[model samples]
Target chain A: MKHQRWLPWVFLAPTALGMGLFTLIPIVASIVLAFFQWDIITPPKFVGFANFATVATDSTVQVSFLNTIVFVIVAVALQLGISLGLAVLLTEKLPNWLRSFFRSAFFFPLVLSAASVSVFMKYLFNEKFGVVNWLLSLINVPAVPWLTSPAGSAVVIILVYVWQNFGFSFLLFLGGLASIPTETYEAASLDGATGWRKLVQITLPLLSPTTLVASVMAIISALQVFDQPYVLTGGGPGDSTRSAVMVIFETAFQRLEFGQGAALGVILTIIIMLITALQFRLSKRFVFYQ
Target chain B: MTTTLEPRRTASPRTRPAARRRRIDWGMTGRITVLVITAVFVIGPVLWTLSTSLRLPSEAFSLPPSFLPLHPDFTSYAQVFQQLNMALLVLNSALVTGIVALGQMGTAALAGYAFAQLEFKGKKALFSVILATMMVPLQVTIVPVFLLIRGMGLSDTLLALILPALPTAFGTFLMRQYFLGLPPDLAEAAAIDGATPWRTFRSVYAPLAMPGLAIVGILAFNYHWNEFFRPLILTISEQNFTLPLGLVSLQGNMGTGSISVVLAGVILSMIPAFIVFIFGQRTLRTGLTSGLGK
Candidate 1:
């Protein structure tokens, strides 16, 4: 095509404008907003480091931070373990129809909206007449308070979050497994390596890159969890399930503390960036990319 | 080592087929057992949701918790529509998702085409800037974005939700990768035939990029359709509520008393996503793997 210098600019204009106005400007604005006190109606006044000071000593922030850490560790660990296990099973030599069936079934939850899943799980874990308690009652077991109690509610949130999200990692692992050349497995088998030995020697080592990606993604999503706990527990009976994002949302929208909320957002972004950067740095020794 | 060697020692090449068949049978049996267990874990709750949605309120909350409702009732679905005003929320969600999907595809394609084919000053720098923004999660920028939307007087409106989401760095990157893989000779031939850059893009390149368009479209649709955080932050009134917000509020309002109705609403909200997934299964699979695998 006849190269026109203006044409590329024309094509790029809408995206640039959109990103500039919404993404780029807001990013800078968020940093600035973290230092200002503003309600929607009133003009923003710069408050310097006051918001950060409050965040440092706030008890709610402390609880939320601890809860978020617990959630990130437990949720990411379980999700990676289960999804990798599922991916390994699905990738085994199986009938074509069965493979597709398992893939679709496992991935089906990813298509459901988080809100829908949350609602479904909320009712499923309801204290009185929930299916879970009812099922427990079938075996002469007493009904457990799934959502009312703090520890139980936290576990429910973790399980539901894992249920809704693990499929993404499963699919990623499946893709990684599919990409491993069969010749490597065949060669290993010829060397009298089979079953668990072959898997530990060849599969785990080769799948390290995929594992790293999936783990990073799992951690990121786990740390950002909001929808499930927001809907299911609303930070619960005692703030046991309150995630950092939940606190941020409630602070900004519910309480109209935009400055503090922005401060929290900034803090969260820095924490996530550091964690992600640390993962990438540490991955250099473990993640093989051949 | 002994464990690995034992299986191999059991059969030589002459007897391998028979022994392998026996092992295969055992493996299949074990595999089926594991598959059933996993399938139950994955699909059981989903089936429970459907059953609860269809059951009478009394049956839905019965102590024993029957898997199948004896007298299935569609009244909860009716209640969701009547009491919750689900139809309007569905309409709002559809409009927002549709606009965002089409807008994202259009912008991504144009930007991707430029990045892939056209040379411009600071192309590399600009592309890198866009790519870097992908790392900034929406939660970080949401506060300022909300303020910006309010400042523009777009709050409580679908525009607030639609405008910010129209341009996506990931979509642009996906399209650029796809376009870069296209044969360059087609565009060259169009150029030799006196086609302008715009004309070449419109006729020669656009048609070839339909797969990329579909991938972006499906992804954008799924995202905006299910998006809760943005709508929750932006929209104020019940009239402007998307399906997720509506369902959530319905859960709160109904409490535990109207569980069937809430389940019905949940099931209703999932129908569109299920339809999209079924129809675009192949495209979505490829899109996810290719987008994230690298």
Candidate 2:
């Protein structure tokens, strides 16, 4: 083949240029924007950490970050736990149709938009007349303040989030479980390992790498949660459900405080990077790649 | 840990008895039943939304909430159209999503093929940079992205939504994986026929990569179709709003719109996605599961 050195670059130009302009340059500009106070209407003025200081001390910003961390921990846990449990159960030798049926059922929610899911969920969790409280009454539990109270709203946000998200992790775990050789399970069975014993001693260890990936992805997305909180509680019953991205969205777009929004965005991005890096570092100690 | 995990020396390698495996274990049945119940919890809400949307507003809150839309009504659907520019929103969503998907498929394939087949300086570094973009959340870059859009004079336009999203790191990676899976002989055969690399790629390799491109296209369509955050930031006018944005504003109008009508809007937004799910599930599953395999 002739050495057409420029052919590759011709192919690479679009993605390379597009990512450079849209993603890479914007990232650099955002970091720079964090230090300057500017509304879109005016020239950006150098503020040298003033934006950061205000964002760090702002109570709403502080609480929103706190709410985000809490959401990540709880949502990622529930997402991984539910998905792993169902994936393991589905691993049992079932009819082919049954297996596909279970896979489809578990992964269905991944297809819906988060905004629409939150919309319907708001009605379902309504305090006065909703199915959730109605079902609770069947078991003699009294009506719960689902959307009206802070604790109730937080719980509803997490539930709605996990309901929509667990499918993704479930799909990953299923793939992980499928790749584990059947002979390993057979050997465990022959060694007189009970179901619980095999799950603890074999399955979980083998699935750790997948667990790491799922949790990393889950936590990153969870930390940036906006749609659910925005739609369901409107970040309300007070600032109980407000999130880091919501702060960014409102600060910049609603308030025209680009500097403050960029500052919050910078802080959020740093946390995401640090958490991701920490997960990789932690993975070195725990993930069992097979 | 090793002591408990040690295999018993006397253990036979042969499979367990067939009849024992064939026996209908109550525990297994219990597990499946538990999964079934969980599925209902996961899917029941969406079903209720669909059901409620099919009924009159007065019937939406009826006790023992109807899971089925028996005696279905089209009035709420009609009401959704009457209140919102249903045609305009759908067209906007379709245009943005369609263009973004096609653009991503093209760009990802080109970059992906370069990495998979063509040797270049800094290839590894370039690929890593592209993949690393995944870690940068849209929120982080959105403010600057907005400024850039304004700089381009594209603010509040559908082009604002469509253009920035054309470069997809994950799609490039996926297409790379797909290209690597294709047999190397196809390219070699083209070369033996004295075909240039450009001619070979156009006539030989690209056609073989159709299924791979479909995976990228479908995944892109699914993502951009339901995307809210970008459109929320980029598109301000009602005329330019996508389906998800339109639905959120519809929720904001709940003081006027009945619950059924609101849910009717929700159901309408889900139709294209649901249709894609039914037809493109395999490609989507393949793209998703293997997309994260790294």
- Model 1 stretches with alpha carbons more than 4 Å out: B1-17
How do the residues B1-294 of candidate 2 rate in per-residue lDDT, one tens digit apiece?
766556543343444444455554777788889889998998789888888899888888888877787799989999889888888999999999999999999999988888888778899999999999988898989999998999999999999999999988998998888778877777788888888888887888778899999999998998889888999999889999998899889879765348888899999999998988889998888877776755
Task: Give the residue spans of candidate 2 off by over 4 A.
Answer: B1-24, B183-185, B191-196
Candidate 1, A24-89: lDDT as tens digits: 998898898999998777888999999888767898888998899999999999999988988888
DockQ of each: 0.78, 0.69
True contacts kept of 2: 0.69
Query: What value does the lDDT take at residue B24 in candidate 1?
Result: 82
Candidate 1 lDDT for residue B19: 82
